[model samples]
Target: MRQSRFEQAFLAYLCTMDVLITVVSWLASYFISSLAWSLDFYPQQGETPPFWWCLRTVPAVILVSLLSYRLSGLYQLGRRWPLWQEVFHVLKATGLMLLLLVATTFFARNPYESRLASVIFLALTSVGLVLGRRCWGIYFRLRRRWGLVDSKALIVGTGRLAKNLDVALRSNNWMAMEPMGFIDDGVHSSVGRATQTVGGIEDLPKLVEEHGINCVFVALPLSRYAATKKILRLLRDTLVEVRLIPDVPALTPLAVQIGELEGLPTLNLRSSPYSFLDGLLKRTVDVVFASLGLVVISPLMGLIALIVKLSDGGPIFYGQERMGLDGRKFLMLKFRSMRVNAETESGPVWASQGDQRRTRFGAFLRETSLDELPQLFNVLRGDMSLVGPRPERPYFINNFRESIPKYMLRHSVKAGITGWAQVNGWRGNTSLRKRIQYDLYYITNWSIWFDFRILFMTVRAMWDKHAY
Candidate 1:
């Protein structure tokens, strides 16, 4: 669809701002480098480039930056585009532009006026570009919230899916999508649902014309094959964007991927997180974090070990079999927080609040979650991840899998020392069903930043009520 005058004006403003920001960033980067190191501190005996001489490259840098952002799709960002993704693309474009600037200088047989200044410019501009785009996005979001222009949306079929989608769009005001109403023969009265019923599928085209619907969503059930086909055929003449909501509301899909299998479209429902590059990135982060954590906390861990060993002259470390990724069992290590035979007779019983089996120091360790420090080694050994679903014992897994739905799905990813469930107070004999829900949510929404947030929350929740 052709963009409106407002959208075109917005895009033009963004382009103009991009050029201005690039110029400012180039100068700012050079100024920062000057403050950090003397411009006369050159690697070779070439004349120190004066400010004007260095400024000559700013125009070229700005041109290349604009081209890079255009190629990176930064200019095509919409209101719905994720801020993180936009920032990432902006940073990538800035890096490319910097590389281009360096290459151009090298090709010209006159290396950068000042190598240090060039490096500083790249670092400064990369950060500035991302911040600039973020500010732009924030301004638009605020404007949209204050009754700016919004896309008119029409939802076909007034089923549960349609109602849910309506509620979601209406609740998230930042979405900037105004759902007009539903168009289904089943729903005649709209006393409680999303507004009044506009009309059935028969009146869809007229409604679109009269209501100025720019976006149409077909949310009818999959069972109504005839109705769905007829609706699509009717809407074919309209120039609106039509989207079909797949009728699979019962299944909870984690990391869904759409691909072609033998020339046929296939929707993967149960996609795992450890696929190719994602797996590599996750493992690489895990190893780096685990190595650093073990080094920094070694002294504290040693002290805990000493205390546990002296409490009863028993083993300092306890290793227990627990289920992990792909249902594989691994010996999870932790500081001993119980008597020698605390669970020998009872056999795999969950420790409760104020459990008498715990030693005095052990109780403190359990309360503070210091007992789980040894699992950092497990992360290093690749038996677990720094963040994932908390591993459960085989004894309880056997029971939960039989009783609870999707209980074993938590094992789809590597178990972790602390998980979304634990930080959210679902640890140590809490509701198993709720734990499974949070574990699955974490798996589906896994990202480096998400992992960092969970880690921060874990540290903040050190004295949590459910730690025991």
Candidate 2:
């Protein structure tokens, strides 16, 4: 699709801000260094290089900074990207720019080079760029919310796809799209009274002209290929942008990604959440936090173990087989919170709010979630993650997969000690369907920041009533 004039202008504005921020960051770094020790970070040295000499690097700084941003693909990133992703790109670009600046100084044989000042500039520019992006995001959101910058959109079909798109457009204002109405056959009325059908496809041009529509979204099903072609042919003379949203009901759960294979367009149906970099990042987080967690809580764990042992002279810890990524079963460790033979008669029953299996202190351990502390070892051992869907025993997994269609999809990632579902109060036999829904939501939108959010919520919800 062609870029709108507004989009082109916004991009130019951002580029201008990036250049200006870099220049200002350099000046600020020099000013900050002036108040401190001398600005001599090289063998050549004199007391803080002449203030006039600082201006010499402005051209190099601006060029390198903009080049770094473009090279990091920040220029192509859309506003739909999450805030964390945008911030990370900015940081990555800034780091690259600083590296380039240092290399240039070494090769240019400059008489004045201050590594300390460069570090300061790096710190300042990172914060400045992030804050600038945040301010722009706020402005963009407010403008869209107030209808100051928006595109009038018209749906070309009235079906399940069209209805879903309408709901999505209304709920997610970040897209900055305003729905004018639907243009389809008058047979369907499920789109609601607010967005009434203007007319059939023949009347699309008239409706567009009347409503000043600038965007057309086609959601016609595969079976209506002829009708879709006719609609596209009719839209040829119009100046509006046309986007085709494929109506593939069978692959609704999987997000569609456009790619190329052997010079032809290809669509991927199933993809793992952990790309190579994502795996490395998550594993690093798990190993670091899990190792630290075990070290910090070792004394408390020992106390819990003693209490469990004193309660009934049984095993201090219990290991049970639970399924993890790709349906791999592993021994999951936990501080035993129930009597030795608690499940001997029942075979495999879920813990309820209250039962006769507790030994007084065991109930407290379960309620306070102290019993799950041993899972930190599993995280460090690479069998689990700090945040993911909670694993279940093979016995229950067998039953759940039979009843729930998307139950097995959660195994695509390693299980967690505390998860999105558990933190959201969907645990302990509340509603299996709702728990699966939250689990799927987490898996679909997995990110480091999202995991942190779940962990924070877990701490706040520790005293929840459903923990039993």
Candidate 3:
């Protein structure tokens, strides 16, 4: 859906503020550099350049800084980023802007540009942008809290989807949409007692006029296409915006992408979140870290291998067939933590607490998660990643694929040695549903920074009770 007038105006205000801030920061940086030079705090290489020469670079600074911020996703409206995340983006964008500005000045042979001013500009711009955004966020949040900028919204159904949308809108108050009530035909009565059923479909226009709703959310199930169409037609003459919340059963975990295929509308039910560049970056990280990890841990691995071999005279390494990306099977490697025929009789049973099949050393290995260290080789082989959904054996996957909703969706990305699920204590005998939930969350929000965060968390989760 196109952005509403309020959102457009808000975005325009942000851009204008950013441009203004850039110009001010540039001017302030030059002023500070000049003052520092006069005070002997900054080394005087030569006579300071004229102020006009420095002022002339304002336009270039704004252009490069705005472009950097835009490319860094600083202007993506509706993002509920935390303060630290916003500051991080500002720092990253400011760094990029500084690099571009320096390159432009150097290539242009702009002798008037001062190195001291450039460094000062980077610091001032970063701090200015961060504080500017933080203040704006606080101002808008207060406005929203006061209901000064809130837009009233009406839900067009009273079913589960409608109720869920209401809860979502309520939770994300930053959207500035306040749910006025529902507009269902009373066919479904699943809405909570707190949410009022104001009127039916026929009373939509009247209710819109009465409550002055800014938008209408049509959250009817797909089975009620006729009713959905009628609601859209009824609201066509009104100024209220309309948005459809598709009720695709069992696909709630996946993101829905709407586009057009040859002028016809298309709904992409399943798609990978990673782009080519993202995949390249993730693979680069996996390869570099995996190689380093294997080298650093080789001595420990050798010791473990020796102990495993002498403890039971069994194979030092175990290879188990497991499903990975796109349902492809790979022999996932692990330091054998069980007897050679551990699963021969049981036929792929999950290890439980105090499982009799586990060797004494194997239990320690599993507890410390050293057993999974060998999966680094799997990562280097491109069969897995440093962070993602943990791969499951095909035997269990066959049952899970049928019983659990969106279970196989986890395989959309390569499996990982340690994962969001494992770090969240959802490994081994935990709730499969919750594990799939975390795995899906990781896939949908995958990023190099996110992977690093999960990897760091994995270190702290090594001794979790669920590790067994």
Candidate 4:
């Protein structure tokens, strides 16, 4: 079937609600700002613009808000986002809308130039949009429970992947997709006993017509390519919408993106998640925060350096070659946390608890993660990001890349002083597989908010027991 009527109606409703909220927020903000100014709360040179003059910008505000929300993926059809995630999306869209308004205000000859009013509009619109979406979600859930928005889906496989997808769909009942049953050429023993095979693949079109199936999900494995092609060809004659659930191997941690090159469809299996704008924003934050961090903690670093030197007269700063983005070698810096030549006899090895190689001050530094302070310079120098997969020594990387699947995928982004793995207690001698899993997760889900979260978690993880 085509896009569901419910989804279309919901989208239109959301757009209408957003437009109404924007206009109401603008008007409310104008009146509130005038009230504040008259009460001496907001001191200004003159009275605020007339109501009709402020109303002149309502259309612009609504247009910008809708465009921002659309760009933020708020209008994506059939999205079953959790309430909190939807609210966050609304907040982001509202923020972007305000930014666009401010940027255009610089060029537009509008008489309504009250910064206080703009601020009030931002707050009012954000709250209004979030509450509006939440209320709609609740109403949608009620409607879904009444079976008014249910969409019947048919699965085209009976394998483990198909069973997993069924479980996922059922667990997310908010999507209102009911799995009718499976259709496979032959039932496998691994198929879930609860969801039996409805019929062979030959019955697909008949089942679709009889059951009024709205969607068909093909969760076949790669080994069944021929059968999958046949199924697609059969689906072509039917009205049900088709969705392919590629059973990609676990080794590929990065998300798959569809690309077109010269009219040939391509699947980007190995790709950096960052867009150019995302990279620029991340780099800007890295440089600004790294610089401020270095300056703020320079004195403490100096004191640590003095202690390390006075303890054993070793180098104050330790620099080691580590692999970073795209497997490039960079000198990662740290305050000296071990005696000179501590690893000479043993060769490069991971630090262990109660290790004899650490000096008295070095042990304290390592325990508290003070040794990682110098890596802020690495961030400033563009050798790493403020948050990402922790860089590993070349000796370890060479072996890990050979034996561990998708280990090199972590290098898709810059190494970080503190990372998702580190903050999640996967640092030091923790499970390499779990650390790699978290690292890949960070890369695929990289966002400014995610970076800030990791940084905050890193502070709380300073005394993590996993640290040596």
Candidate 5:
């Protein structure tokens, strides 16, 4: 496969921008510092110190600017453009860079360094750098459209998405992408009249040779992982760039992303929403909190145990196998809220209002959600988090997976003792669809603040009307 001249040029521009932004951002730092001094933001009289002092502020500004760009993805040129997303980003990056400079000055008390000068440098430099790059982007994009830079693309796998992608690629002419045709996989083959399936997946070499294909996009289904893998492996010998469009089941429940390992694409089927340092911190919180909870509630747990034993001579503790991250099964602990072996007859039935298995003492525990308290042990065991989407029974998960798209996406993160579903009062015989919807929201927008909010809500929802 041939390499597109346009892509080469665009990459060159990106590299140039990375260097240009660094240099210009650093230089502007000095001028900004002087300006801050003039504005009385700096100390009026500071000792004229060694020139090495200036280097401190300059390096800090440059590092922060690079971080801002990297995190904001300022260099991913192909991201949706033509809207004010670029302008919005520019404003944000520039503002953050300036704020960072202020913090550094406040932290470092140096006699020679002018805190005022640093702020001025950061503000002016950031504004100039971001705005300048944006203007260049607009111009470069417009110029690339005129066949000045273009990529002849061959998309493998035909369907509405490919058709739409083809139209978008063609219409955004400045992107320099030209769709040659759609190569339908062995499945559906309504590739349209203008398009033809040059050859089967095996004949990709000949197709690439004949069409002079510059790019090969594997827009196949994720369910066809084997086929997608084969197509990728076969294309390795070709020079053409390869891109994949994830299948619908893998695509939905948006905001999730595929991770890579040593250049091989991988489904991040499991992730501890908190990783490395944060994970260590969250676990510390869980262990310390759960241990205290056990100590504080031991007497009450004992009282509940006696009542359950007296009522039906049932097992004091309930141990139900539930699905955890990556579909691993773990025994989730709870106070007994039903007959000793409730699932002995029919398996995995939902606990309905006035469930037949709910003995006299069991009903009280269920109503107060004391039945779920022992799951604090699940948290201590590391099978669950103090806060997250509630882990469902394997039986229900299997049932839901068949009907839901990306249903297991929630399992990517740790299962929770109490979750968005419980907080929303959607647990236990409530709408499964609504519960899953909340579960998805929690998965997508997860953050420390979100976890805290869910924890707060769980407390409030304990007495909630819907909590039976």
Candidate 6:
């Protein structure tokens, strides 16, 4: 995930708090006169904290705060406003720490221990420190972005591309990049298009001087090699930043994507599900919900196993190795969904309605999703997640891989028992292209809310038309 300014501020604030507390405590201890104190709460004269306590605890507090920073994404640098998210991180961390600390303190003493200061120290310092950093950070970001202070930019090519870029710069509320209009190589349509083309390619010097263009982008077409070279040579005299946007390749399979290497801007041809934060968040949700399901339904799972074994005095679980998650093999377990000898005849064909291979109990279990209960254990085992592209048999995967454009992209992440396709009625014998499209969508827009929605729909559509 990209780092954000709020996170930086939060980190800064955490550091400030450590320094504030340590300095305040030390100064107060050193400066306060014992003549003004009573035995009620005052430490006797010369009973102040040893210098070593401040040395050790202050650094320890700062170290702990930094660790908390990593968990909270307080160091995650990004451009957006980090509103309550920073506060949420701080609170979650502080609460977890407080619980741990209280436990540790209790363990240190039998009954009576110092908890009064602990409560005050946690409540006031944590809130004050985090909020102060947030306030200062927001102000800093705003000053750098929206205030007249900003990074100046210039586009070298003219046309729809330059116009679009100009519009983006103009409309962007964050005052980060200020676009100084087009620098054309000739007095063609390109010049007319770029906010009144700041003259021709020869006028680069004048354009930079007049409009104060600090950053130069060479958005030149492949055909304009000679002109682009000339412009580069001309730019040697100016102390301006130069960026080249190669027309043909860069414009072809492109839009912005996360984790894209900035230097190799021309050779971007692959697609990923979500760019950055979205992917991480989806995985996070998968871990949480899958872990929860495994924990809660564990007993019911045992009952299912028992029922399967008693039905035909056969194996309770079926462990069929399936291709999943970047082409790795893992035995997918489920309550036995067929007679012990079911696959002896036709092998692993897709189950059909009233299929003779399926045991009477197997049909019920499949219909009710009880057969999937064992997959909760699979989730725990790290072979699968709660939601994602459902794994297919190797036979089907091999067959589809040839026909599908980016079929293997599905295996980029762990397979799931339930998925966007299942909830959207694309499960069962659906079109491979459409199913892959849904899988790609799950990969791209995956988020906590999306997974939660998919799960909610999955539960609602348990007896859906396509389930059979």
Candidate 4 vs candidate 6: the TM-score winner is 4
In terms of TM-score, the best-performing candidate is: 4
Please list the residue runs of candidate 4 whose C-alpha ends up more than 4 Å from where it truly belongs after superposition.
Answer: 1-7, 38-41, 77-84, 167-175, 188-196, 249-251
Each model's TM-score?
A: 0.79, 0.82, 0.89, 0.91, 0.55, 0.60
Q: Which residue pairs in candidate 3 have backbone atoms (N, alpha carbon, C) closer than 3 angstroms, thus clashing? A: none
Task: Show the colliding residue pairs in model 6.
Answer: 3-76, 3-77, 3-78, 4-76, 4-77, 4-78, 7-74, 273-444
lDDT of 6 at 430: 70
How are the candidates ranked when ordered by TM-score, highest leading?
4, 3, 2, 1, 6, 5
In every candidate, how many clashes are there?
0, 0, 0, 3, 5, 8
Q: Candidate 5's C-alpha lDDT?
A: 0.70
- lDDT string, candidate 1, 1-468, tens digits: 255544567678778877887788678766666655554453435444567756777677767887888876676633344667666666778778877877876786554466676667666766776777667657756765676646788888777788877776665443456788888876677822446677888888888889788888887776764687788788889987777777664565466666887988887777786668778988999999999988999899888888888888999999999999999999999899989988978778888898888889989998898998999899989999988999989998888899999887788889988789988988887898898889988988787677888999999888878766
Backbone clashes in candidate 1 total: 0
Per-residue error for 387 in candidate 5, Å, reads 4.2
Query: Model 1: runs farther than 4 Å from truth?
Result: 1-20, 27-110, 113-151, 167-178, 191-195, 221-226, 247-249
User: What tens digits encode model 6's per-residue C-alpha lDDT throughout 263-358?
Assistant: 543344445545477666766776777788778888988788888888889998899889888799999988898888787879767776677887
Instruction: For candidate 6, give the lDDT of residue 211.
Output: 68
Per-residue alpha-carbon lDDT of candidate 5 for residues 83-130, written as tens digits (9 for 90 to 100): 355656666666676566567766876444555554555556556655
- Best-to-worst order by lDDT is 3, 4, 2, 1, 5, 6
Local distance difference test scores for all models: 0.78, 0.82, 0.85, 0.84, 0.70, 0.66
